[model samples]
Target: ITYRLVKEYNLMINILRAEVVANKAGELIMDIEGSEQDIAEAIDFTAHEGIEFRILKSGITLDEERCVHCGACTSVCPSGALTLRRDDWSLVFAPEKCFACELCVKSCPVRAIVAVMHLNGTVLAG
Candidate 1:
């Protein structure tokens, strides 16, 4: 499917994270970029092939009230979605780049970062 998307549809894919259980199923977190028509067609093709494609608006939420600005989550964030501001040393979250990996959730001592799965504007269990 990835091969077809690149060769046939001429789309660019950047894989963020992937988890595959042998002979069972796999999940991929990626960023795909291309022309609008090609992208739409690719999505249609994926759906036809029984692939569940979800567009995530937000993957993780940061509670400013609970957060202590310790920046411990930054060490485990693979996508740089969680970072500390240089000027004031405050924590920042970029939800668009997050892949819902849940590393920050476990790393946070203050339980400031919470993982969320959003599909079509609906929040689902992570």
Candidate 2:
């Protein structure tokens, strides 16, 4: 029951620009951007659509300086929503698709995973 959807939640937020549905126990990856208020509103709409979901969190933290680029999160991801890419530049976090389970932070040999908390109390990748 894994699903993925990428939509820009910034421009037209009166309605959801995209939807991802997981009927059973699984993972979902959403790509969207907006303020906490916007996200909350959107999630509410999504809930009415009858899609179950979980959030996976990852980002820079003050406790750890950097991620070791281990693919632990990618390997153990049950829903196939989480992915670790080997980019030439750096580890890119896709907010839209992340479920925020914090598995990457938990299994990291080094403590580099930091939760990105928004001013509205919504957490994102820092």
Candidate 3:
């Protein structure tokens, strides 16, 4: 699907994280960039391919009260979604760039980051 998007629509595909279980199924966390029309066409193609694609609504939730700004989560984050400011050493989160990989949740020492998955206006398992 990703190949088709790039080759056919000239979209840029960035796979942040992926999990594939042999003979079962696979999940990919990715970012696709293209022109408005191209993006729309790419999405339509993916849907026609029997691939379930959902725009993630919720991602990692950080509790500032519990967060200590230890920077543990930042280390494991593959996407630059979670980062620490150099001057104040404060944690900064860019929710839009997050892939919801759940790496930060396990890396957080204070358990400040929690994973939440939402699909089609309904909350799914975290």
Error of 1 at 94 (Å): 2.5
Global lDDT of model 3: 0.85
lDDT of each: 0.87, 0.50, 0.85
Per-residue lDDT over 1-126 for candidate 2, one digit per residue giving the tens place of the 0 to 100 score = 112222533423222234536564434454455577756656665676676544443343424246656656566545454455556533445555555556666766666665564433566546
User: What TM-score number comes out for model 3?
Assistant: 0.59
> What is the per-residue lDDT of model 1 for residues 6-111, given as tens digits with 9 covering 90 to 100?
8888899988789979987799877787998998899899999998888754477889999999999999999999999999999999878887678999999999
TM-score of 2: 0.36
1 versus 2: better lDDT goes to: 1
- By summed lDDT, which 10 consecutive residues of candidate 1 come out lowest? 52-61
**TM values, all candidates:** 0.64, 0.36, 0.59
* Candidate 1 Cα errors over 4 Å, as ranges: 1-3, 11-37, 46-58
lDDT at position 47, candidate 2? 74
Task: Arrange candidates, best lDDT first.
Answer: 1, 3, 2
Error of 2 at 81 (Å): 5.8
Q: Point to the candidate with the largest TM-score.
A: 1
The stretch of ten residues in a row with the least summed lDDT in candidate 3 is 50-59
Model 1, residue 54: what's the lDDT? 82
